[model samples]
Target: MSRLRVGLLANPTAAQGTAHRIGRQVDHLLRLAGISVVDLSGPSAAVARARAEDIRDSLTALVVVGGDGTVSLGAEIVAGSPVRLGVVPVGSGNDFARSLGLAVNDPESSTRALLHALSRPVVSVDAIEITAAGHSGPGHRSLALGNLNLGFDALVNARANRARSGHTVRYTTAVLRELRAFTPLPFWMEIDGGDRIELDATVLTLCNTGMFGRGMRMVPDARIDDGVLELATVSGIGRRQLLRLFPRVFAGTHTSLSAVDIRPVEQLTIGLRHGRMLRAYADGEPRELLPLTARVLPGAVRLLAEPSGSMTADPKDSQ
Candidate 1:
């Protein structure tokens, strides 16, 4: 049999210093396994993506070493392509890795597991294709392998992304800070060709995978292979109730609350009423302002993950 050839893409800015070290270790391990490895590390996302695009035709798989942002970049490169994608979770909020049931918080183990999975069959999974209004120019679309979120969650992510220190705590602090000033926004959504429904919502999320915010089960019943997106909406609630609801998300028990609504959908158009400027984030990366359409691209990409057993982990316990 021919030897396996894979490309390694490492995000140098991911996890501050952890990603670079993990990439080196993973590259060493793959070499020991007799796999031909290509170092695709770059100074920025654009360069890294360009490197992947240049080498994609020759590689059997592309292993991304970083957080969700790095993985999101990889998804864009491999989406609709024949190459399979592997992930090494080494970011602050490894929600994508957690959603895949991949081991997080440990680089060596996750890298080993990724290698083992690459040796087996690749798993086909769904991805979200996002097209924002007024941004449909060539190469204007975005891809998300995990979840897309708006409203208060997007605000918190924006704040967290701007912070200069900490990981999970940064997100938590952002959430707390934003809650003090956040109010429900009027959202209008058309789901799977259904009628447009308007409601006051604190947050809205479109999920290809169930978890976000470092393993919060925002949509507990979501499945990556289901060929459908999960829409989750949280209605207006007081500050104390919102705080209480957030902790429950780690256990996926927030779904039981009356203010929370979750449903499976194939496509949706979302916008804010009164033309307010609303931002949406996919895989923790910011997207264009709202009034966008999103659809589930069934089996759009192949992922290398755990072959069997449960891959999902409790964020609370892991943290």
Candidate 2:
């Protein structure tokens, strides 16, 4: 392997224990490859990011050993910097990793893939900078590794995030339950500084990799390095229509539906037209609030992904 100084970060309790086990596996393999590995898995996500930020100048790569949430943490630490981002997907939702052609739920294969990636040069991909104010305080910024979900998907994510555990079953259950209470959320969207368009959407998401909810393809044409974002929404749908439309998402065939719309833009602004505030979610974590501004930051991150001309993380979110 080439000369490498890697920082491995993992949440011990992530994915019910897979993260801890995989972190050790990653560390062992890196050392065996004659690469120096640093344990940056601090007590919490904040600590881990702080540690990474402190030593980022010395590290060639920051490898996240968990799911999409943990990967988002690594991106927060490394985006727009010299350090390359690496992923070992052991989390419940490896949505961010699947697009890179990496193995899921298999520790040996995923770690071996990372080992292979380390021997090659990193790949450049786009990131998103989403900025919005909190509900009661000043605004904060967040990096999105996979997507920024609004409407029904964000509603589901908000529910999943509040659970004792973040899992596919939890998210899926939330999806089912939210369907009953979820109404058409009317919002105003201004894409690329165009006029604000009013629409009621059931599932509206700004996608990077187009994969979320544990490999469900919300936007099949989304490309990580495309230098743009896709605003995907399914509007004008009732409960029964939505029920059938959602299953098609897993097959990536929902786009064929007339109600489903996908628009590519460099920047977008979305907010509630009237109702209560709708929370924004990315990679199953909550951030900011509606009246959010998001844009694509092309080539903001470098990743150690399996070569396929595509595979991607986050830019510094604006306040």
Candidate 3:
């Protein structure tokens, strides 16, 4: 048989030394497996210049070596294209990568798992499309394979981006710092003609996959190919309540809490009361705020994963 052509799009800033280490490992492994690998690391702006269709025409699969944001960008490129995607989880919150049963901490094992894909068939997964009317330009939307979060979750992500400290310290510190000043916002959600549920919420997340923020199971029962988005929200809960409920995300039973709600729907619209600049994040990167619609873009991307049974980890959720 012939060699399979592969492409990689990585985030250069995820970990201090992630780029160099992951690049060498993946390149060496795939080459040993007789596959051609193309590396695309550095500025994401380059994605606009690179023709994904042209790359897809030549490559058998495209592998991403960064965080959810980088993978989401790859989804935008391969949404309607033919190339399958492989993810090497080397970023600080490898949520989607974790969901893929890809190794989050073990580079060698993950590369071995990825190499297995060369002889395997591709798998299809669901994604969400978030459309927002921003301050300028045509209204926009981006593809997200893991989660679309609003309110407090968005605030945490924003802080993580602005943090001057290191990754572990930055995210945790931001969460604790924001908790002191985090003000729950009132928003309205309308799902598929369902009555609008008004809420003063700390966090409202529409989850496609089961994990986020380094294995936080915000949506424990979420399944990417289920043809629906699992909506989970924590309304106006106090810090004590958050502490009480945080562990349940890992087992997914937090939904039973009076303050938390979990439901599934095909589409949903979120709007703030006074139309404030409510932050929104899709797959961990900041996107435009509310006055937006989130709809399911089914089978939007092709991903590589071991067959379901070979996948380890209890599907237990703690979100």
Candidate 2 residue-wise lDDT at 89 = 82
Q: Give every collision pair in model 1.
A: 101-311
Q: Highest lDDT, which number?
A: 1
Residue-level lDDT tens digits of model 3 in 151-178: 7878888888887776667877778888
Q: What's the lDDT of the predicted structure labeled candidate 1?
A: 0.83
Off by over 4 Å in 1: 134-138, 308-319
- What TM-score number comes out for model 2? 0.91
Return the top candidate by TM-score: 1
What total of clashing residue pairs does each candidate reach?
Answer: 1, 0, 11
Model 3 clash tally, residue pairs: 11
Order of quality (TM-score): 1, 2, 3
> Considering summed lDDT, which 10 consecutive residues are worst modelled in model 1?
310-319
Error of 2 at 112 (Å): 2.2
lDDT of each: 0.83, 0.81, 0.74
Per-residue CA lDDT of candidate 2, range 1-319, in tens? 5467889898886788768877897789788878889998877888888888899989888888888888887887788887888888887778888877788777677667777776575677888788873222212567787899988999888888776654767887888889987789989989998998899888899999988888789888788987998999888889888888777899998888899889898988899987669888888788778898888988788886655635532323210
Over 4 Å off in model 3, which ranges? 1-3, 47-53, 133-139, 193-197, 309-319
lDDT of 3: 0.74
